[model samples]
Target: MEKYVPEKDERAPSAADTTALPTSSNERTPSMILEDLSDSGRPATEEEIKTLRHVTDQIPLRVWLVAIIAAAERFTYWSTQVTWQNYIQYRPDDEIPGILGLGQATAVTVNNAFNVVVYLLPLIIGPIADGKLGRYRTLQICTAFYLAGTCILLGCSTTPAVEAGAALPGFVVALCLTSIGLGGVQTVTTPLIADQYDETVAKIAYRKNGERVVIDRDMTIHYVYSIYYWMANAASLGMILTSLLEKYISFWGAYTLTTGVLLLSVFILWFGKPYFVLCAPSGTVIPRAFRVLWIATTSKFKLDAALPEKQLECGHEVPWDARFVKDIGSGLMAVKVCLAWPILRLCVGITSSNSIAQAGQMQTGGVPNDLLMASNAIALVLIGLVVENGLYPFLEKHRIPFREMARIATGLFFMAVSMAYGMIVQALIYKAPPCYNFPLECQGSDGRIITEPNHINVLVQLPLYILVAVSEVFAFVTGSAYAYKKAPPNMKSVLQSFYASMSGVGYLLAVALGPASKNPGLVVLWGSVTGVMGLTAMDNGQTRKDPVWHGPFAHDVPNSISAFMSQYSALSLIRGLTSRTCTYELKGVNFAYLPLARPHAVENSQPSQKALSPGLSDPASDNVHDRPSGTLDIPEGYISTGNYIPNHNIVPTSALR
Candidate 1:
């Protein structure tokens, strides 16, 4: 392997310029960049080699606690939220008795509004976790709020107060409490799970296989989060249970069950406090971020600040440190990775609500209504396991990587792909034997009444559910992993909250199409959603190609090229084409990707050697002096490899050498 350095100062280049073709000296053909492992480590001992086995092998125990906390919270959130439309909107019948008995429009409106609040609250709470209350404490407080809300709803639902529209105001109050709590906890806990392992501390040992393996941080983080999602879905088993309770027992039973779960979660969180590695709150990055941007902007206009260095230095005698500026750049690049998330989520808002409503319309022989909507959560658990345990390890062993940007793009494509299935299901529903126009009370051709439902089975929707599940694993699980990896040490919760907010933004978009949600208009709406999502997928690809702020991603395409090549790989797919899923209920509602910059792990210079290694750094360097990690300063290349990164590209490793 050879050293390659950029001729220009890499810090200030626009995204387009940095990503444009590299100068010849540093440029590697896709072939040259695909060379063999260039590690300088000594041969592994037998005992060391024995330990190297699987990517999922050695996670710490506390990580599971965080996963439990996530799962419990998700269960409570989904159990209640899943039954909302039927509980609030559908007219009362023996099989499906109403709580609020509000009209369909009211249910949809309230649900959408509640979703907006649940997702949006993270924006405020994230800073609180980062700046004041540490993650562990914030998690505790937020969860208490969730428990409190569940108790309130349980009380209101069980008592006579819930009889009519009387319970409506109380329900609104409950929604507020749960949304604020759930949003903050969701945003903060993902980073909390990730923080369990130390990435910078790579503990290398020889595997029993005689091949040395790193107890790798990045891949471990990815794997833990995959399980995190799968576990949450498993916990969301509440969807089926609670919905059943609503249908058979009473709506109060479901709320009671959810409250119990939240209470248990709170206990476990506090019980395990001694074991958790709780990092204290680092002050908020957003305020510092604003100041940095302001300084960068003002310096651009000042006549005295001609040089890039001068611009950076101008007011920085004002508390703006170099690393903080670098962090802002990193955060921006992460934004590019997820920039398409909100727009992508528009499809989610449309489908989830519509799916529930459509199921309500289904002529089920005896199937429950909540069961159909619960499919999203169920599918997440099932497909998530297959991909994580069976597929990912296989790909890693073969050196085939699923690139972050590429996986997210695949998720976006599947968002559109799932819709295609939805369109088919809708069309089938229209053509079913019952009155196609029955929602409007249709009269048959022979003057006979078409009283019964069209005989089409609700099971036809299984395919769409499966497709959506596959998409969720591909998109959402990986998206959480990506956010954690790319976030700055201090601002992890804030970055994650930004990622979570995309769902709200997407729902905001979906809210615009509210009028068309009813029957007769639904088929047209689904078909339109499919088309728009496909275009959005293409747009996401373009964002991966070039982002707005141009920090980390602009400089880092090479590392992702192979990983992304999986979607484009010949005949090797997870499950048909749409397996690349993104985001979750609120979480899945966001994501896209761009490259990220690696900080100083790349160079070969000795710590003691102040002198350059020939063509490497200059003795008279123009860049500001960096605080030492003791490694010699080597600016990172655009593409840095990840643990499971693949040799998926057509070019052979042998060809590169």
Candidate 2:
């Protein structure tokens, strides 16, 4: 091994460096000590900083196994999910093959309602996984429900069950069970897969190509999620097979194949148990979180007051400690970041249900309307590959920061564009001869109701699906990565579920708008969705100024420090702090968790403020009231102000103002 050797003429360590030393003997290795010793911890030289590149670590085999599990689950899900609209809308005697013979409005309603249930159950199941059952046990139980529900759905699809009047009720029960299964699996699976790689801090490493790079855990997570989503969309191509089976074979055959795929996922989970990283259940987080919130409220919103030492000083006791307070604060920040998701999800709900119905009203050229939904899967796979391999690498090379919030905003913009296109398509479908303003309602010469759809080709819907895919790539994948990165291990499932449940809220809105899925109202429905998404995109762009936009704690530190270090003045102060020893450490700083800049701080700034930094003045003596409303009280240089390690006390300071 190459060894680091300290120079004999190196100066003695400063008191701050000694205080910051790790207690563990293993952590104080010779290499580490020498590594610290050789450091001129003055701000990085401009050339040194400019040449830096962030890249991902090699993904583990165990993580791939988990990803395969997720892919299989998505395969089974979209197979059934995409087919539901056709299954509910048409009759066996009609041109389309279906069971229930419900109208388009009813089909839209049922499909979105199913989406609502699938997303909503995560809230109930997430806590159970986090606090009681643990991820592995919870996944196994949910898979069992998934298998049972699929079996029941297969039985309900049979001709005998339909004649016996048992099909509808059985279908309802199956939907409920399947929803539980899917929601629970989704709540636990995302975080569990991400948990396989636990390294958070970035480090300098050499690639196989012999190029030096920074192995960034955040970038690695970005790559992982991109791969995860790509696999999901690739697996969703199974919808084409299921749609074909439903058309040529039967719904029974379709359900049988999907149920088999689901079984494969279950088997993988069972077999991979030994290799997977399984975390044991950490007892109730939500209840304790509420208690911490109560403590914060009583103490005038100062979260530091919830610390165990603070509680002891006040002659009281609580179930949590200082770390848990930080966890809760981070969780809430994740929640705030996700607030715009519901509107975006509404766009997804429309694409899945109403968009399918819209396709049925256009010329399909003998292809099943449900098959067009597969276009979304195709676009997702293609776009995701290009983005992960092409776009992200380009960004990293150029050091262009395309953070999570920006990605989400880009997604919202795409969603709006997609919905606007859908509205235009609906208008064209309405304008076609024989249908004029009403599709599927025009009468023939004999005054009999005509079933023939409008003259518009179904392929026109491809652009809309392509747009939706772009949105998913930017918005949904980024959201998943954000949740996993920010959440504390114990609260991972809880936070992921809350993020997911927004989809249900969006679908529920679609369900409420069921009546608008048909005729002239289709135009209004698509237009309304377009408007909501557009406004949300604008709002999200503005949120770049918000504290939640700082991103994950790990992401904040190095980037902020590097940017701060680029200044010659900062280098001088760091050198002064080191007493010409050329070393300084930012100790006990918690600006990562603190919302430093107050509202209107950015609006009134000259060019604009860029980052928040820990101010030099002692935090314990600081008063928020003493500072100007839109000003952050930064000192001459950034430094840790006090011995605030355990409690992680906040000093609200903004830099680059």
Candidate 3:
């Protein structure tokens, strides 16, 4: 109950108080009440700011429910999306109708265009979620559009009107609607999950086995994102089936399977509504944050990181509080890091979109080009586990903290190397090929034109895929956490949108570079990508409020659908659909989605109360609110408002266990 009101006597903490925080467990026992009050808009003293990274918290079980919803969504989106490239580029004259069979150049262009729409839509949708509809409501509306879009596309493939080589207009319409839905779902989902946790305090916690530790907001969020990332990748493994389905069965089957998953996600979200702690949109948070940024940039304001408590005077009067000014500073720092992503992500674009194209050129030993992504997904899952649990903790223990910026730089380096690797692969493919330009027409002994793959092994492409996964581990995964950690709480979704937008920018640039994916330009394309990525390489971050990862597209699917990823993805890359006509291609965003699962403040279920681990105790300050006698049963800092007042019957935090 000791809400942070400045003391009338001392202006700030004394030099002695500013000394390093307690290193031993006995020296630093935090009070849950004090920590809870700190979360309720309490200002940090100078010293607290410096040591913030040292603490982390246990991710609540409720957050996992939200993660599950995102997983289901990833499963559905990928179930059908991994088939975009082949559906557009490969002409099926003998097998089935090649509906709207645009050439490879046109198809990749369309794919880029679709990606641009999906990534950019977040800008529009983010504001709406924060101002008009809340995140939960926004998700519902978006999911409907997503489902409808899939249904329309499904009918396009199944209807009798689509003749062999004929174009389907409904198909384009479906992509548009789904774009909005995808954009809307992505912008709101991550932020919504973040809001579910009680991030008001950090405490000295223990591993389930009694090892002493610190649990704070940053670690808690990082943990949630790690789990969120792993779940999304796990769901992506489903795309293997969808790829086979679209190849062997019908596009209708693939799209239908997707719709079913989408429906499942929607169902989970609706039924579990009561369990969630819905966040009301904070009006115009993004606008205000940007305004602060502008004011800070243009004005004569000087920032001294060592003294955040002493607000510097603004260069211009925009009527913002000191806290708002600090938030703007934080926002700008994040953006500075993010600016590098536009280039770094291009490597991802090349590998995810163009590499799949490259695979199509080389002779496949009966394995699908998109199947290589199974390696990427599996690598990401394992990396996530190893890095977050094994590596990160180990580093922290050794006092060699793994910085986010450094992680991002390393990721960029991986992208550079991967691009270079692809460049080499492309060169070798040309050297060994019968058709030098690939998909080349070779003359048989009888003089009939034979379309055969080059002699290069398809598995040679594994390094590039593995590199992309490794890059994601460092760049994409860490970036998401960094964005969440660095972004102003109110402007979190906006920051995430900023992160997602980089992919769109990269893809747009990729469209311009689409020609590079072709013959002589293949070397130039990969070489240029390598050079650009290496040159612009910088530290960065990604998110739901954190970036989500998506995978590449596949064409045909079997009984299973496909796996689509988000920002570790933009998630639309892997999805391809088979068109008997091969004339049309459906490219969608591959971001994962999950049904919403909120934990209610019920006993023996999930705890809605702020949890404080053992060995933590708050100072019995004079200003602290008096606890009601015998109502010790009430959850700590339980603010009774609306209809309910504190009563003896109220359940305590102990009731959670």
Q: Best lDDT goes to which candidate? A: 2
Question: Which lDDT tens digits does candidate 3 get at residues 356-449?
Answer: 7787667777777666666777888887788877777775554332455456766777788898999999988888857765445567788876
Q: Ranking by lDDT, best first?
A: 2, 1, 3
TM-scores of all models?
0.74, 0.78, 0.71
**lDDT digits (tens) for residues 276-351 of candidate 1:** 8888997876876776656545654222232245545654344555456556655655665666777667777766
The whole-model lDDT of each prediction reads 0.64, 0.72, 0.60
Question: Which segments of model 2 are wrong by more than 4 Å?
Answer: 1-51, 298-300, 541-657
lDDT by residue for model 2 (1-657), tens: 011122443332434544465567766533344343433222333333334455667788888887888888899999998888877888768877788888788988998888898888989999999999998899999988988999999999998998888778998999988988999889888988888877765555433222334456777887777778888889999999999998889899899999988888888887879998889999867888888878776776666678899899889887777778777666665775577778888889899998888888889998988899999999999998888788767754433445665676677778889999999999999889777677677888999888888899999888999999998998899889988877888989999999988888988898998878877788999999999887777655222112222222222221121122121221222222223111212322233122222222211122111222344334553322222244433221123332222223334233222
User: Model 1 lDDT vs. the true structure?
Assistant: 0.64
Worst 10 residues of 3 by lDDT: 576-585
Q: How close to the true structure is residue 239 of candidate 2, measured as C-alpha lDDT?
A: 96
lDDT for 355 in candidate 1 is 81
Query: Which one wins on TM-score?
Result: 2
Give me the runs in candidate 3 sitting further than 4 Å from their true place. 1-56, 94-98, 159-161, 164-167, 207-210, 300-318, 442-447, 538-657
